[model samples]
Target: MSENNKIAKELVEAVGGKENIASVAHCATRLRIMVVDKDKIDQPKVESVDKVKGAFYNSGQYQVIFGTGTVNRIYEEVTKLGLESSTKDELKKEAGKSGNWFQRAIRTFGDVFVPIIPALVATGLFMGVRGLVMQEQILGLFGLSPADISDNFLLFTEILTDTAFIFLPALVAWSTFRVFGGNPIIGLVLGLMLVSPALPNAWAVAGGDVTPIMFMGFIPVVGYQGSVLPAFIAGIVGAKLEKWIRKRVPEALDLILTPFLTLLIMSTLALFVIGPIFHSLEEVILNVTVSVLSWPLGLSGLLIGALNQVIVVTGVHHVFNLLEIQLLERFGNNPYNAIITCSVAAQGGAALAVGLKTKSKKLKALALPSSFSAFLGITEPAIFGVNLRYMKPFIMGLIGGGAGGFLASIFGLKASGMAITVIPGTLLFLNGQILLYILVNLVAIAVAFVLTWMFGYSDKQLEQTNEA
Candidate 1:
């Protein structure tokens, strides 16, 4: 048998065969298996499977790590074992049932925001480049004055930096629709309509550059340019409404009427009702978050940094995308990303320490790549596969992250983008503060490494004991 098939067979047996698996799915790096009987799992055996870095049960799924490309192969192999397989969405639905109300809500928030991150990340990198080129020192290197730079080139940069936020509502709505089992295209259309050119631009209205047209005499209605909550809430309402409409409409007419009524109804509700109310709520939320983030002595920074990994483990870290967006919209830049980058670096540092300290060949192989992955701002491999497995390393990482975050806040480190961190995140600070960004990351890595080496991990003594 092939290596994939070999491992797949072992994994299935370790999880109590195909009968115990209610549903199986893979996400990025882990095979998320929902099992009928948790006790039936042979956890150690699962961990020992070839190419399997680690295994854990979280929320409601038995997650087996196979790292990036390997997980997909193992997933395909597992499906061939006559077990029921599920899409990411279907797995999310099943897993959602196991968590408490708060946990479920956080997961839902992650579901909505995670899909929109790539757009934000791309925009952020463009913003970083834009910031760099606009710098006097950077322009001096090219012997070009700010006025000497072509207006057309500057205009293109503006488009790159501005387009994502300008159409953020549509992105949010589309993802929300997918999460809620609605027609994504229809959801996208409704979202686009919420920010139609016919309405006053939201940013212009906010800046008092354009007056919002009065609706029903008193309600000031404008396009939801950078608004998130309204589009997300509208998506849920539109999706549920569309699903309800789909059931009642005749099949022949369903194709035509369902989309029409759904769009028409959702557009009306979003603009006349949901948009105005949620915009106000968004403002309030932004204010609260800003207040907390601005807390004295870097209190908020330390708290968020220390617990960020824990949040990521629960799969709700994507909500930070919303917070980052809000911060950038209100303050023209986000310091939170700077803080988050430090936390991310600490995980890599801790994993590196563990990798160097471990005596087991399997553990060393797993730790090295996972650490590198963490440094590149995808920390799952390090977190689930290594650090979290050794509880002390995780805590040491948090302590290091908190210290780094506090320093970042103290120095007022900020970024031009929401996504991308650690190594790639250097671009966001390249305009003038790259050194500070580098320093914070170095501090995080150093602290986590030293602390983890001291107290976070051991050199296979426990493994030898278990074997004996």
Candidate 2:
């Protein structure tokens, strides 16, 4: 079995076994389960698992946090163990997530990228503002060159981003244990121990050097500072271990003894095994990014442009921010982000078209504002309220976006700086003919507007909606 599969099986048993669960599903960073008996669900028992975030019984759902990359693995493991079944009730829960394949695809993509967005955005704006400051010499930003100011900031930003990911296991443990419906305070304590520097340095052990914290080595001291994999794995281990430790210890001394042993064992496993394996996977992903973008620019841009629009809508769009700003800062002109510019045009055009076709004073008011908002790059209001609700407008917008992004890629278009207007979208496109690129963007939007009007304006639905 895959290691994740083994961990899931153990977790399933720990949480009062598989039969106790009614249903389960996962989104980006959490494993959501519905159990038949809440009483059988032991909060402290679940928190004991090193890989879990604490559990919570909110909205009648048991939510478990497993950090970023680990959720999928857990989902795969959960399915293999038969916790999630194909049934109507389950499908209904998914309805709110997304319905059509296109929408679901968008949601799935967003699920992967959303949680990391704040970190990504903070890092990008940090670099951008840092760049502007040095160029203007406002703060007299010190660096080897004007560009160096931004580069230096990114170097520091990387530390923050990398650190969060590095001890990802700890994050998962902390979150899972808290959400597990236990004493959340204890779960948070478990999380802290996984990330604490007091743990033995696993890196030293891997490198064949004796750990300075020799006592911790024999005992499994996990160091999760800015780490991802170890803490997560440890959490899974910790969860099961929690159950075993609970029955033996009396209620009076349970708090101190439970966490102390849980950390001692789980952290060791994290340092020696979980952290190392996940760290390797991260290296592989970085290498792939380097290899993929190294190919011809035109093809790269087109692919990125197409995928970018498809993924951005689901809110996972934040993941691409790294590909655009961070990748370009280092590798130059990240073509992957080029596709998003076309998406903005497509949605804005569709919204405008929807507005023009509607005569209902109320609908017209909604659609017109939606169009303007879409133009400003907030397309969800337009997508969910205006386009996807009807059907044709959404398809038309996607087609328009695809075509526009494809063309932008072919022309070697590049975006230079972040700007608000549609005209400036082309500024990033290095197409020697900047004005031509802007015109093309306008045309793409117009086409979307026309297509949406042709397909989406149904007399019956409009009349019905108007009546209501």
Candidate 1 regions exceeding 4 Å error are 464-468
Lowest summed lDDT window (length 10), candidate 2: 416-425
lDDT of 2 by residue, 298-399 (tens): 455446544554564444454443344334433334445445677677877887887888765555665676667667656644665567656677777776
lDDT of 1 by residue, 10-59 (tens): 99999998889998999988999999999999987887788987788876
lDDT of each: 0.88, 0.57
TM-score of every candidate: 0.93, 0.52
- Segments in model 2 whose C-alpha atoms lie over 4 Å from true places: 1-116, 136-173, 179-244, 286-338, 341-345, 373-378, 407-447, 450-468
Query: What's the C-alpha lDDT at position 413 in model 2?
Result: 55
What's the CA error at residue 32 for candidate 2, in Å? 17
